[model samples]
Target: MPKKLPEVILYTDGACRGNPGPGGWGALLIWNGKEKEIAGGNPQTTNNRMEMKAIIEGLKTLKRPCHVKIHSDSALIVNTFTKGWIDNWIKRGWKKSDKKPVENRDLWEEMLRAAQPHKLSWFKVKGHSDDELNNRVDALAVAESKKF
Candidate 1:
């Protein structure tokens, strides 16, 4: 019989005070029914970077391999993973079809590598919703941004 993998649930969100200003990333990790919050910020960054960082930080926190469900409000993050954008990026040597440089390629590559070890699924959640955990994460992210 194949071994059973533990289930891991992650909810992530990112906020940018300005497109290229202070930005924050938030994440919620749930394993074995216990929940943990992870969040951070950068003084000069974009929303996409924050979204990627949220996932990277959450994955880094895991102690062992597990099946992971990632929920994020950013369609860019969710769709990129789900629609094979990262694979295409790698195949093109990190350049887009139009031959433009991939924005945040470094973080996107890191996110892809971090996800490689797990059975992962990406889900989209509505931002600014009333979901308690999601709301908490957003608040935490915003608060963290103020420190930068």
Candidate 2:
């Protein structure tokens, strides 16, 4: 018989003062009603990189593979997996349909590696609106960015 996998929920967000300036990424991981928050920042990074970092960092924190449901305000991150863009990109040697190199291949590769051991579901949420957890993560990301 196989062991049951624990279910986990993750919420991630990122913030940057300038387009290519100081930035931070934050995430919240929940399991069995307990939640853990993690955040970090870079001296200089783009909003998209920070966004991907939040997800990658969150997944990396997991001790073992489990069923993970990831929620984020960034549509690009969510869509990259949900809409099968990652599959095509990997198939095309990390090139987009336009034959250009993928902008964040490094992080995208990390995202794939961090996620491969688990069952993943991606969800998009409205940012700075009514979602309480999303708002909390946004606050965390913004606060971390200010520290840099």
> Which candidate number would show the highest TM-score if scored against the true structure?
2
- Cα RMSD for candidates in order: 1.2, 0.9
Please give each candidate's TM-score.
0.94, 0.97
> The CA-based lDDT of model 1 is what?
0.87
Candidate 1 global TM-score: 0.94
> How many steric overlaps does candidate 1 have?
0
- Write model 1 residue lDDT over 96-122, tens digit each, in one string: 889999999889878877877788988
